[model samples]
Target: MVAPLKVGIAGLGTVGAEVVRLIEAQQSILSARCGRGIKVVAVTARNKSKKRGIDLRGIDWMKDPLAVATHPEVDCFVELMGGAGDPALSSISAALAAGKSVVTANKALVAKHGVKLATLAEKHGGALNYEAAVAGAVPVIKTIREGLSGTSINRVYGILNGTCNYILTRMEQEGLSFAECLKDAQRLGYAEAEPSFDVDGYDTAQKLAILASLAFGTKVNESAVSVEGISTIAAEDLRAAADLGYRIKLLGVAMRTKTGIEQRVHPTMVPLTSSIAQVMGVTNAVTIDGAGIAPITLVGPGAGGAATASAVLADVADVARNVRALPFAQPVAKLKTTTKAPMERHEGGYYIRLMARDLAGTAARIATRLAEQKISLESIVQKHPNGGLEPIDGTKKSSPVPVILITYATSEDAMRRALQAVQKDKVISGKPQVIRIEKN
Candidate 1:
């Protein structure tokens, strides 16, 4: 048998500690699979006294994190550290510069500086693998980078954030308010103390950038994605979605358009019958649309110690097996400079909700505004009034009623212009609620 492949690990957090335990428990299986034993030769963390439920016997303990990356006996460096800068960035660069293969679960690091690190890895003849970076254990990265290599991919999208998904699912199923669901998520440890990163759409945006690069053979562009959070999604929006045969999900979408690549992360309305809608409560689902084959959707647990560690081990095993592939599934020189497609150029169906005075000819005015922009409505629904209004000056009082309109395929620019015209007519109250519709 070949000598055991030595590994070094940094950041022994939830996922990192589990990775150590898992490698020991599955040692025999991994060895058989890779034709050699996989061993954790060294480890590092913030506190050495922290009691992790794993034996660290016979392994080198490093006080300084960077030493783990450049250790003499270490064949591969596993960075479970979660950060976009500092130790994570400098350490990974040191590992590649030392000609050591790297496997990391840091999406922020990969999304922000993937091309430069990838180029460094290639220059040093080192493999850089990150199966656990996006969507946890879903293996979506490998599926795009290898499984569909020969095909031409048009689009890749999915529910990439588990915290937002859990909140949205609870809101829809239990009819809870956004705040209520968010509190529940925090209690359940699904959300962080500071939840803005996940709930405000930046986490999903980072993951989408990595997926876009793999799917389109383009350089990762974290700043290019248009992002919107689930903070403003109300119970009424959920009710409206269900009434229209759809379910609301926070989605990260990347598509190739005529002008360039379009990447967006926002709350979306997908058909109730769609497979992605069926994925609920902290689970994730990713779909890849490629030519000459039907769309393929991969759904599974998006997070947790065991799931993420399993993904990390898979990449480690691949490295042990001497697998060599570019980080973006194509040569760095061949990767094209990405042109960001403007949101105004997006063509799609939309769900628009407006509150207007309950009076005759109000709907006609809205229709006229839409018509002026050449936006055609697929359906118009006028919900019942909120309540009877009190009479003022002995005149019949009018209450505001909810008017919901589903538009056919139209440009976002046209929708915005039409809504501006409608708002100017003084028939509407408050800002209009608009959610984009995804047919597939």
Candidate 2:
């Protein structure tokens, strides 16, 4: 008889507890699939006495994460304590050093210390699986690392953060301000009290780094990603996007470019009919453009205990099946070094929302600056306070007027230079809101 795969899990928080319950509840299904039973032999958490609504009887309760990682009977160590540093890092390292397979849902750890950890796993002949680190329950890691390994991937982009997506969805659907939507998201448990990590695009950047490494055979480098958050996005931007046949989404995009692999996270203007724009709320989605094939998009619930645990258990099952794949889709030594791509050199269409000073020659000066930069406007609209549009006739109004400009494909440098001239020329009231238009 084949021995069951003994599992040790650290951190009995929401995700950890759910993992245990899932293993027990789906034991028969998992066993049938992996050709062996799966068992939770050991576990550890900060608080053992807390009521987690799951039974942990017969499971060895270790004193700490390191103990669980180094447990003699554990065949696989699952790290659910989410931080880029120890003891999650140390424990995962210890498990890999011990030749026990390691699974985790820590994107930050993977983003920061992935190469080091993968090197450890390689040296010790153990598997390092972090299917839950990026998009929860999406199976994107497996898709990119194994399923599409035969295909050449050119671009990978998506809405990776549920909190930001939820906030943006509310802002667009209810016409709420970013602050208002963020407050509601917090109250609904979709956002943390300190939501800067999610809203500021850092969360998406980390996930994008992981995906970029997998897709492009590069090392995971979060610092290489150019990041911009959704905090600056306003209700007006979303409304204007609707008027212009686009939807504003916070997207993390990594693509092959002439300069190198370009990784960026920001509020992007996606066409209304695109697959990514159809996604809303807390749901996460990733679209992969590969050579010799149509684009592949994976969509699912990105967070929550059940969704994350699903991915964690899937990684555990791969260990149970004795499936050992390279951690970053290749040996760490072969993974190329990634440098930060210059955002100024990025070429794309742009959406510029300017609060133009309603004075004579203001419109002409703005147009002249863009023209000097060789930027051609695809469309331009002067928005009235009540969501109406008037021609840009340089007509003075009671206050500053909202002028929306959609430019054809242009370099970020040109757009920046033009906007700077507009600002310096005192033709705009406040900073011009700029969102890059992503081509589908």
lDDT tens string, model 1, 1-440? 69988999998989999999988999889988999999999999999889998899999999866999999999999999889997999989999999999999999999989999999998998999998999999999999999999999999999999999999999988889999999989999999999999999999999999999999999998998999999999898898898789999999999988788999999999999989999999999999999989999999988999899999999999999999889999889999888567899999999998887755677889989999989999888766445222212222237777778899999999999999988888888889999999988
Each prediction's TM-score versus the true structure? 0.97, 0.98
Q: Mark the 10 consecutive residues where model 1 has the least summed lDDT.
A: 387-396
Clashing pairs in 2: none
Once all C-alphas are superposed, what RMSD does model 2 give against the true structure?
A: 1.1
Q: What is the clash count for each candidate, in the order shown? A: 0, 0
- What is candidate 2's lDDT per residue for 1-440, written digit by digit as tens? 89999999999999999999999899889999999999999999998899999898999999999999999999999999999999999999999999999999999999999999999999999999999999999999999999998999999999999999999999999999999999999999999999999999999999999999999999999999999999999998999899889999999999999999999999999999999999999999999999999999999999999999999999999999999999999899899998999999899999999988867888889999999999999988899767966567666787888999999999999999999999999989988999999988
Number of the top candidate by TM-score?
2
Off by over 4 Å in 2: none
Off by over 4 Å in 1: 385-397
TM-score of candidate 2 against the unseen true structure: 0.98
